[model samples]
Target chain A: MSIVRLLIGGATPRALALLAALLAFLVAAPAFLGPYALSVAILILYFAFVGQAWNIMMGFAGQLSLGHALYAGLGGYIAAGLFFHYGIGPWVGAFVAVAVAVLAGCIVGYLGFRFSLAGVYFALLTIAFSEFTRIAFDHWTWAGGSGGLFLKVQGGVTDILNLRGGATLFYYAILILAVGAFVLCRLLLESRLGRYWLAIREDAEAAQAVGVPVFRCKMIAIAISAALTALAGVWNAFYYNNLFPETAFAMGRSIEITLAPIIGGLGTLFGPIVGAVVLTGMGELFTDLTEHLKISGLKQIFYGLALLVIVIWRPAGVWPWLAKRLGVEERGR
Target chain B: MSGARLEIEALGKRFRGLRAVHDVSFAVPAGAIHALIGPNGAGKTTIFNMIAGVFPPDAGAVRLDGRPISGLRPDLVCAAGVGRTFQIVKPFKGLSVLENVTVGALHRHADLETARERAGAILDALELGDRRHQLAEALTLPDRKRLEVARALATEPTLLLLDEVMAGLRPTEVDRMVTFLRDLNARTGITVLLIEHVMRAVMALAAHVVVVSSGEKIAEGTPAEIARHQAVLDVYLGDAAGDAA
Candidate 1:
């Protein structure tokens, strides 16, 4: 039985079949693609994973965090640092990375929700925290300061446990992660907790009148989201073989994390993946085109135009509209 | 099984310098349909807010079945067996009608399937079963009002607070709501504390009536007694006369 059909929500059987086929195609993708193309596929899966992490916070719970790169960056530094300085494996270090990321999310969620900072104010608070981390990490010499941190790839042995393997190994690992994120999000969406999240997202005061615990539910959203985002950070460190404080905690990177879900469909189960595919595919295509044409900055302008067009064309996003056209749309979504 | 299902004594609130509610007290008996009636801005809703824990009073105490509930957060107040409806009737716009009520029902069942079943039952009882899958924001005003009441009832509350659930309702719709509420109270033995200005529904549904005027409790008795009370009459007819003059 396909995992799509096993999901608790009542997706149309046609939709399930379509999803299963897409997964099969992705699983077989490396056979048909070159090294460079395989790398782009890896980028899509990464964005899909991280985008869902951000979606659970802003999309499902409606608590916007504009500085989500902090979680990823912090997780990467912790895991990579442990692996580099101490000879611990990335698998073991991932635990510590996830815990730290959860702690950071909790602190930010607590201060924001407790003090009634909402919407743009909460977003600004997140940006401030990320900015603070960036500046602090730039001066911290122990972790290589702004110059960056490098993972010492072991000389001869290809240790899969340590996450030192070929590109295909990393590709399969990320595929499992993206699929896992989708399943987990579906499970959470089908639970009683998900109902409370929707209520809080729509009208928090109304939710409280009928017994939904707004504060605690929001906190849980952030914690789970941070934990998943941290795992993505761990993957990034090992795959890239290096991390720079400037690139890891960059404000531009933080904004990019939100682009996928917003363009695909916020709060929908498949929005993040769909958003990831379109945005990353278009972004890479534009970058390649601009490079070939000897033009420098057309990539960003194209991205901005795509975002503008999508927002103006379908504010609710491409997935909802596409689902409707495909005859697989859920009611009341 | 007890004295008052809900009680507030000397309940007072102030908005900066202005006293919104002061020296007001009342007790609602178990299984009774009670009404708090007043003209617009008479602080009836203010008293409701204090009881439902939207805000604490400047000075007073609120009790449910003889246990203090004042100063609890709104969600905690609900967990303490109180459920409330807002005058504005803002349902979760992204959620279906069933999902909106299921959020409240989960308070009792603590799971998705049972909560959804309970919400379905409440929707059927409230004649919203047909529109169960519709987005809450898509409902008509009367339907939205009914959705507010339905959602509150799904919580399995011992005491329900209703703030103008019948406001903006047509006469026939109001009558239907009154009948449904009266039947609900009689069948379930759930206590109801309603803030309303719809006198006809008040007379039909409420066994006990409390009237407030300018943030002060002016009268309290059976509906018949309150209709005949001079102070209640002055607050209503006197205000009308002043309006005319």
Candidate 2:
């Protein structure tokens, strides 16, 4: 609490100024960057948003889901399907998307937690559900089967209601999403529910003995994580103008969702954001460099090396080390 | 019978026919400090596990103030006014000492603010106020034991079952714990059922003692009575019987 207080009220003026400047930079980024660079910025914000969502389950509650891409993919498909078929806007479709994802999360969370599945078994259960959903989508011709689903492309005027726009619109759209996720994660982390999660994460038995409702808390984590990730999926289909089950619900996509928080800091508030920016920025940079050098696979090698270095140097992730270096008043939990 | 805060009714548990605990029945009258003692692997902690709802017993029942809590989940058992500390001291290692207690305090206290306030008071009572900011993993064994007690006490439990809280403490530390527990019982009238191997602390703190060996109850009486029992002496407290008496 003192740490929370210190960060909120007693932090040095320099740190406050730095934060304000960073916020200003993010808000004004599109004015200075070219269209190509802005697209990369949009990707960073997208990862930042989804990373925070994934962090809620694995970081806050310690429930590992190796199939988090299921939420994003399902959300995108449902919203895109509504827009394509019923002429409905994604704004209205998002609710249905989130509900479907939450339902999926509940089934998995209920089965995993009720049956006492922990660690790898629970991870496998999540993967199974995700794979099942991907397969179901692959054969469903109404949702485009294995071909893919695409929103109407913009040739003239950008429609904000339908989320039909240029790169700048999505840049702000995902910026809002990433910021919303950051705020929500902070709120949950400081609230009573967050304490229960940390308790369960530490030791479920000890938590239960202390009257912490382990199953309920775990389910809530999964639900919230899925709900948030589902929103990202909605934005994803609109921004990219396409949804492919192979790319969206694949195991590789889930790994991409997890990398940011794991690299930044597993359970910290700023870890996902910082990790997203670092990983996404570095990834783009690596891709650009490799393309210039005519080395196609070097980008993957860079990601592997970056993960290895972070794991070896800072096992808790980059956020804690960075926060301490900047004197950000983190309690080092 | 009405005075008894905790009652065990021929409680029995079997680990696939291993007979871990069998037909053990006892009661700690409200405001009493009771002790369950035995040698290693004698199912003393197993009995605590049963009462705390770590798992349901295969046979018989446990009642708290005329309410059956035998088959309830551990959280439900705690919500029914039972709080317990593990024999191995399972503190939430990732949390601070204050946060650890606050988790239990929140069980009864409605909100985080009040739960934190109550947890602070409990820490002060247990002489852990100074170390409340430290992570549970950073604390010494004695502090960890007190932290376990503090965490349990924060639940505002009518019954606090402590499993070997004084096992690894020094003589002075054990005496300090005994004094603190005695004052706590006097002040709060919370019924305590502790499982301890420390004869000095057990003798000092427990009003009633139940001796167990080989998963079955050998004797039950006042501290001095159990300390002088022949079966207890032969099976368990052979040398420490004199010290306890």
Q: What lDDT does candidate 1 reach at residue A28?
A: 98
Error of 1 at B94 (Å): 1.3
Task: Report lDDT (Cα) of residue B194, candidate 1.
Answer: 92
Candidate 2 ranges with C-alpha deviation above 4 Å? A1-16, B1-4, B237-245
Q: Rate the local accuracy (lDDT) of all candidates.
A: 0.89, 0.88
The DockQ figures for the candidates are 0.80, 0.71
How well does candidate 2 match the true structure in TM-score terms?
Answer: 0.95
Q: Return the clash pairs for model 1, or none.
A: none
lDDT of 2 by residue, A59-130 (tens): 889999999999999999999999999989989999999999999999999999999999999999999999
Worst 10 residues of 2 chain B by lDDT: B236-245
